[model samples]
Target chain A: MSEILYRILIQGGSYKVIFNGLLATLRISCFSLIIGTILGALICMLRMSRVKVFKFISSVYILILRGSPVLMLLMLMYYGIFARSSLEAETIAVITFSLNVAAHIAELLRASIDATDYGQVEAARTLGFSAWQAFRLVTLPQVIRIAKPVYQSTTINLIQWTSVVGYVSITDLTRVINNIASRTMQPMITIIIGMLIYLGLAYIIHGIFALSDYLQTRREEAA
Target chain B: MKKFLLVLAILLVTSSAFADDYVGFLSRLKTTPDEFFMMMKNSWSTGGWVILGGDHSSSKARFYDTLTQMQLALNSGEIDEMILPDFVADYLLKINYNYSRCCISSSGKMGLCFGFMKENAALRDKWNEALSSMLNDYSLIGLAYKYVKNIPEDESYDEIYGINRKQLNKEKRIKFEHFKDAPTVKVAVTGDLPPVDFIGEDGLPAGYSVAVLAEIGRRLHVNISIINVNAGARTAALVSGRADIVFWYEINKSLSVQPDVPDEVILSMPYLNWDKFFHVTLSDTE
Candidate 1:
């Protein structure tokens, strides 16, 4: 299978296209993960607020994002929102995916915050801690611990979902494979290469997640 | 009443005279020049008369001989209506010319004859009329037979000789000949060759294999059709009697060691030569 893929990639300038596409995909996924996580934390705080209007708005936001498919959302943002505009497709993909991931991440973060031991927050409050200070000291740390596994998986999933950027003509890994197959007239060879590359990238992501999990466990054991 | 009767007789005589002229023209041109030239003349005369009256053919033919004469004729402004067959009119009018002529031989094979003219509206209209008339007169079945019977089998030996000899002995050759006429000996090819084989435009088939097999069908007098199939299903296409030939396959050395092909199939000689290349670009730093 690798041999077939190797032949196709080498023939049609597909290898370079795939390499560049993979790099772009990684860049977008990583950027979105960071941005979405920060945004998610902020949204979670808004959700936890005492204000009724704030909670309702946050609920509506999450409902809209979670209710729609990523593909439909991407298209809406790209064409519907930016009609007759001259924004690049890659920019649209990044914006759309980051916003989409933020919605789910916000829900996960809110759950983790709610599940935290209420006694810890009360103890901090009893010791004359302000609301912000208590959140910084006790609540935030515990939420991170509970949410880390979910966050890690979301990042991995974001990486996979980035493959759909090819639909907007961003020349992602899948697009490169399609182009090669068309030029060489060999679908079997190009598709096999695309699958191997995807698997390899997934393995790298899993390794990084495993390392982070191990480090977190060690820190807990030390404490 | 007498004048009315005379007018009717005159109309009948004129109609018969025109028919006689057409028949005389066909007889004169049939034995003289190439078939294409004769067909062109016939098409021009018939199409011109049908569309516009007057001696357009003689004037058009004369105009073709000299550019100055054509210009003079244009400037003179004596001609009322310019008559042209579809193709020629299309060129004159600067319209998009998208017509293609496929020569199908008697054996049910197809071959491309000519194509790809730029926009020429006047010429296109003229050519269209001529083509329609020509199509009505010439039978596709007759053309297919003529194309196949003239295939120069002796010249094709260099391409197929070695493979055919290796695949079949004298007895097998005789058997193959018998099988060629077998009612069930249907040939099918996958209509999937990237850009060339399966083009997106007009949905018309264009490719080296399509061209070659169309000729073969004409030669064999068999009907041919293309089916789109994936790589894995290619062999199955043959075995299931859906296709008599698989057009695309790589020459892999591993086939000798771990042969995956079934025994019922026979591979044909390689018809195409391909070159492999690795393209490299210098780094930005350099």
Candidate 2:
């Protein structure tokens, strides 16, 4: 175990590169998550709207984004769409990943909103609450509670998908690990380290979500 | 149990008819498609695949991400035959002690030369003039021998491939000369090509090509900057101005396959050349 640890930490000063890669992965994942969630909320609102045109627009957007593979989307964004542009690969990765995540989040949010009891909105209206007021106070809070679990999962998936950013020339965790493994000719140990890093990141995200859920439940109990 | 053992023995004997014979090829999925890939593809379809195994199946052609993977596959029985440079095979067989190879053909003429943009004709001429001097002196052959000394010592070249090694003075020397005005040249090479260009222990590019280029730079009064790139990015490196020269083997075949490579890029005279491909295989013990 010590020898393995020594090799992992000491060989070729590769740990530094792997750490830098982890940071790049996190940066892309976080920025994409924020952008995706905001865009997803807007998409969810449009999808929930009574207007036929808005509903149609949201449906087409979801259909296209969800249909394509993330790898294909990333390639198109980097090599085809931005082939002539001066945009850096990391910027392109964020844009592509954000668009990808927004489609799934839109569906998740739409389902959560739909699953809310319609009678609650009716009750709010009987108490002289406006449609906007009813949605803001009664429906939105319940939607958050119902959607949080799925939203957490979607965020974790977004983080993992950032590994393929290497296709566009961004040195994310997985790509760097593969490069090191190729150079050292030790795929077994290098792969384990990569997996451990990803597992650690995933656990942190899970912990934060769990903590949020625990706090929310406590606040409800207090109420 | 006796009946099962008898059935197993029969099955093993029957499976021997389809003995594991895999020919490894570098795919564009990982590396760039060069003349080596094209030649292998053509040869496989024509008859080379049958020579190694019985028939070409979808499973017979194994794809490798890097030459190192191909080397490992050659050891692990994942692949039986691999298309590799003559020198690389010699070095591996010398060290591994469990691998053997047979010469396929030394008749294929391919030039390993430096490439430049069409507008850079003056630079190309200067480099070509320098290369000719080295080729005449046999110093380049000396350098190749320094890195790899395994020359085909048998009379098989003429008998099988109709090429006479002795008549051609297969060895050449490259002289090192200082230039009064050395221009800085950025050269691109795929670092995954072992014994030619590969990442060394210190995480920097090191190999036979690295040594050869360093010597060329010294002689030409040119400062050489090597940009290590993937096979896929080699052409792009030249087109995007990231590299001024590309040290590629067989420019005609490598560039012909890549449509994006512009007509403006020109190939220099052959400095390094390989005449044949060898059939690399594992010994029974391995």
Candidate 3:
């Protein structure tokens, strides 16, 4: 067992490759999550629009993005949509993952926003604020508060989904893990280490969410 | 009315232009075979599709679930041609034969060999000796024609090996060794590959490669256990000491593509040579 551990973690500097892969996964996930959040916020507004055309377009976008598998989406973006484009696979991966995350985030945010008390927006409106002001001051804050936990879960899912970027030849964590396992021919230890790293990432995300939740609660209490 | 007619003409022209673009793209495609199944070379310099690492090489193409899907992609005009080993292409063509849609383009031969750890040099030589014997005795050819050529049973054994059933069994039987310290060898095999290494219907690893390994083990007087693994895990199985040997093809090309692969592994003698590949496409006859 110690020998297996040594083979996985120490032998021939295999950990370096695995670490590089982790960085790739984190890079893709971070960029995709940031872009997706911004795009999703815009999409949420479009979904909530009074105009039928805007709502229809947003619904169709959500349906298409959310309906397909992320791996399929990544493949299409890499091989089909961006096939002739000079863009790198990393760029294509970010775009595909962001679009996919945006669709889900739009729905998640929409549900949270809708679940909030409409009377709060009405109260803000009655205070001589415009519709936009009411939504920003009263509705958006509550939406964020409601959606915070779900957002963390979605972020972790996006991180996991980024593993498939290897299809486009991006050496994300899973691919690197597989590569190490392949080279060492010691799949058990290599894979266990890989899984532990992923699990650690998940725990890190979970802790960050928990910390954010704690801060928000304390701030609300102080208020 | 003229404006409406002009808009309709423009739409028709635009759609047809899109179709033309699709056709043009198909004609220019250079497909590389995906490594999801049987292991082979990725870096043959004959306009074969090479799946490049994430270094963002200009030539890297798409990854398919399998070779058959890649063939389907080729037929449906999604890809122009697949650059796969002659052995794989032939195997695919035989099972999914439609001669009208495809044609074989013979490339130069690739040497197939078993990859071993540097420490297993003695074992490698022993296996090499066994392979040479099989090659000389025409047993290997018989095995190849049986699995690779898909020659009919009953006829292939006698016709290829020139030995009847009883003699063939006798030739395969292991002699008892009284030695207590003979090492048991563990060999890694991907049971997904047919005619080479595959899980038989009876749930045992059975194929030409397995039969060869068995014969080698019999002669060496060592117990050989076949460890089944996913195609991707073959190398890791070797490096991790989970399996001492793996049947590999075109080791030089594989190493060239994946330079990060440790220098510990070495190749045995080339057991088989595959030099022909076919381009499968939709027939223009329709």
Candidate 4:
């Protein structure tokens, strides 16, 4: 126990770096999540549009962003796209990760929409419901429910992927852990703690989804 | 139980793919594209990473993304011998018993210097002046002896090499002074190279570069902030204006060690020349 403590907390007072790194990770993840969601909704709308041009553009965007490696995308964004621009590495990382997440989330939303029962929307229209009302009443709920679990998975994945931010000069959680490991020469212990912390973050997101599911069930039961 | 296991598998696979690189798919995510291509070309070898001799000659040498991977490959018997910087090899020999180290060759070494923007000639000259003073007075070599040449032979009381060995103190970090109204220079330190440009466990930059920068800051009365960057993005930091100066390792054209100033970014005078590279292999008996 003391050995673990020394490795994580005492040895070189590494916990400070750990905490700062965690905060950087959280900040980047949060920024990526928010911006990615908004951008994803736009792509989803574009993919579902009646205009062929919009559909083609959305298809290409998804194809490129989804197909390319995130690490490569990040480096290109930093060293190529925004190379001359006076943007910080972390901001460039957020932009890159957000684009990648937006692609995946767009696909996720489209799949959830496809999974929703069109029959219910048709039935709602027959029962004198407007298009918006039918979507709000029948289609949206099912889409949200269907997207929940996968959304949780995607969020967890994004959080984990943020570890690569260190590659771009950001001293994130993973880098801090690496710093500690390098400083202390206790790779096993330091990595175990890092994994546990990441696991804890993943579980927290998992728990949030689980709670939403339970609340959703209660609401359905009450209705 | 099934869900727990599924998540665990995902953790191992994904984290290894993109994060927690110490134990990952050995060659997949870490290395530069060039190094990765090298690994692919030599796909038969279970382990491959590059280690340039101190003499700046690398042929048939493998490349690694991080030092930790080198250690992993060496221990797993994937590689015959691991080549490393002389200071680091000596430090590792003291702590690790099974390891035996030898200098590979010592000739035609490159100069390590501070890189700055093309327009920032004034800032470049300030650093050059400070470096020249250090070189003339031999204070730079003295700092290297304090940090690099003086690794403790005892394997006991081992933690990280962040603590200065001679003083046996972690608290007294050589830090840059930030004056009340002085111009602040954001210098990037990778902390990848230990005992030289390394960060201590105290979360402070303390090593040869830090000591030299500290003295320069004191002499010039300029505020200097040492920012830690990954070794890969030193140039990115400089070009993006995120850092005013960065440590650059250059193989120059001159006979003796001289600053190889590139056209786009000027380089300060060379502070250290790594004339010796050490190759360490596991002792058979151990």
Candidate 5:
């Protein structure tokens, strides 16, 4: 075991490479999440719209994204979109992941919107607010509140999903672990380390969400 | 109490008979033309499926043989489970194809075949006492070192003598003569092949190529860095001066421009060899 572990770790330099890879992974995932959230909000609005065509299009988009495996989507984006073009792999990964996440996020957001009491929107309408105004002033805020926990959980899933980017040649944490395992021929040790890092990231994200929830509740109490 | 016990024994026998009938159904299912055709179709759709397709009848027969053997082993509890080793399971399964045989071939003196077999929990436990001793005796590092040393170094006819061990050693160990004046020796490899260039869980670059490079770096006392470049971006990486060395290259006989890469791109001696062969046996049907 020690022999295998020795093969994985050198005195200094290798650790730096792994750290850099992790940073690249985090940067890509965060960028994807931000893009995904904005796109998802718009899609969610379309999904809830009175216009049948708009709702149908959004539903189909969601169905396709959810039905297909993320791995296949990543491949399609890399080969289909970027292979013939000038876009780099990292850029392709970001776009693909963002689109994939948007599909999931749109569904979550739509659900949250539906979960809001119909009375709130009706009241806003009675007060002479437009449909958009009702959503913004009365409905959207409650929906955001209700969806925060699910959104946070999805963010964690997105981070883990980012591991697949390595297939497209982006050196994420899992890719690093795979390299180490191959080098050392000590897959067991390398996999354990990778699992721990992922779990650690998940825990940190969960803690942040919890803290945000606590603060929101505290503010409500103060009011 | 005696009557209840007899009734329970009868029920157990009836269930066992039903199980045998179910196994017969599965055995028949394994040989159906439609089922075999579907499996082939699935394999074609998936990239790596090894198509044993010749005659449909023969393919079905082969399938039945494998499935029946597997089922018998399962029912008898001879081998409790079928377990694929990580590398084979992960890499091989990703490609849609049919496998001719489940066991790794032993022709190349590769150690992985045995390692994969040993991954079977029942086999590992059954032979644990003997296998443990054997494993302790087997030094994989020593074997790898021996294998690495045996690769022949290339020499030009212009050389005073064909490159010998002494010259090879000097060439490997010698510092780049232009290193002091030249730009840093940066290397790039595809980041997708983990255990080649990517960093590992230990927070280090631990792939086979990386490990070799790290050794080379230590011996030469040069500051070397491995840049993670995507497969499609390798040419761009070289042209942009982002990397001085491409970590991998394969020789293709059919491609004319294969060897037309940079003159500075020194090809390493091939460290591994692979060969494909078919085992033929005369059969009455043929």
Candidate 6:
């Protein structure tokens, strides 16, 4: 009986419930990373800007988002800010996560940019390289190398945090596992399976980052 | 990077200013009954008591957010037994025979009903009217049985709930009134309690309360939207206006207990009541 129950949960069509949930998690994480990258760059510029107002707003944004729990921010965004709106929970999750990632990535970019050796850029300029060329050739590569691991960590944390989206009624991976386990009254094996899947997901993300680093190194050597 | 660290430090310090009592974190952890009683309790519980800090005023029993979590904790030996409503225990034990239920010594009784914000008093009344009509015809009781008594014990659980067996129970999943011209009201359900409140495998709200909501929607002539949420977040969902109505338990006079109901919530006339509590443990414990 236990075997049949486990089989029906995994091999049977009920597994599709878990698969669809994984897809939702992947969609939100990927969307947040893409939008966050763009927004992060903009926010990074504002943080480093000479304009006092923009700098103040950017600092507060970073302080508010980075200092508080992401789950709390997601709830505040969903229930407090957009409470009256007819927006889907998924939409709110994406928007909230994107904003959170933006704050972290912005600070990451600012710190990395600040840490770069300006002497190399000056040397590139002296060699008749334009400002953009100097940044592209001498500074950007260094910044990426310095920021690669932290950025990957931030993105991975964002993915894991998406588990909390179920609080708002969005059926992400964690919620699916809980629903299945609770409904069937078979949580031991179910929880083990869920844990294995999450670990696998984290490994996949880690591998992607490793591959990106390898490719970046290869490009630099080839150049 | 040093300046960045400094800024973060300032933020941390400033956040403490917002807390009225900032004696630091260590002072906040409340310990009770001195060290020896705690030692005995810890020895009794195999370290679970230390985690729970037995007999603490501020904390209650090890609170689990969902039924699954509670079961996991039990299996892990973190908890000995789980206290649950009689029907919920019945539903759980029906699926998994590995678990056993024991009688709990409690006379507390509570009734399940829909809760709305004070501002939505009229909406609450409308639902009450529809509920009365359903009760008058015995359809409400019948609806509760759809997932519980209606499910034949011989059949597979999947087939009963249409998990992997979609072709089965095509008519079993209740469809609510989706009137195009009528105003829509969003109702929140945790789907944590199966056969009573749960989502079907096809990712639609199933079970008794959903069926009741469907019948009420028909009588009220309003479109009903069901939102799935974690059980712990039900009240938050309602109070935030994400759900116009959510499940709220009303403690009966016989129970003589004031439930931890929110001040803003206005409960509807209860549609279902249960007086029994059960202590559930692994079957091996029997």
Interface RMSD for candidates 1 onward, in order: 20.3, 4.2, 16.7, 2.7, 11.0, 1.7
TM-score of each: 0.46, 0.68, 0.48, 0.78, 0.54, 0.82
Best candidate (score: TM-score): 6
| Ordered list by lDDT, greatest first | 6, 4, 2, 3, 5, 1
Candidate 5's TM-score reads: 0.54
Task: Tell me the tens digit of each residue's lDDT in model 6 across B50-97.
Answer: 222122322124546678777877787656667676677788777677
In model 2 chain A, the worst 10-residue window by lDDT is A179-188
User: What does DockQ come to for candidate 4?
Assistant: 0.25
TM-score of candidate 3 to 2 decimals: 0.48
Clashes of each: 44, 9, 9, 5, 16, 0
Provide the DockQ value for model 2. Answer: 0.09
Error of 5 at A34 (Å): 0.7
Q: How would the candidate models be sorted by TM-score, starting from the highest?
A: 6, 4, 2, 5, 3, 1
Q: Which structure is stronger by lDDT: 3 or 4? A: 4
What is the per-candidate TM-score for chain B? 0.30, 0.64, 0.61, 0.69, 0.34, 0.72
Q: Tens digits of per-residue lDDT for model 4 on B1-286?
A: 9999999999989865653212111122234434433333243232322334332223234555455556666666555466565666676676556677633533334457788998999988988898888888988888878777766654245556454453565424675667898888888887766666666776677777788888888878888877777766666778767678987454332232222333577777778776554777767723
Reproduced native contacts, each prediction:
0.03, 0.08, 0.00, 0.36, 0.19, 0.67
TM-score of 4: 0.78
Docking class of 3: incorrect
- lDDT for residue B42 in candidate 6, whole number 0-100: 41
Model 2: CAPRI class: incorrect
The candidate with the higher DockQ, 2 or 4, is 4
> Can you tell me which runs of candidate 6 are displaced by over 4 Å?
A1-12, B1-60, B106-108, B151-168, B248-250, B255-257
- Residue A219 of candidate 4: its Cα lDDT? 93
- Give the per-residue lDDT of model 4 (tens digit) for A12-130: 66677788889999988989999998999899999999999999999999999999989888877876788677787788988998999999999999999999889999999999999
Candidate 4 C-alpha error for residue B169, in Å: 3.2
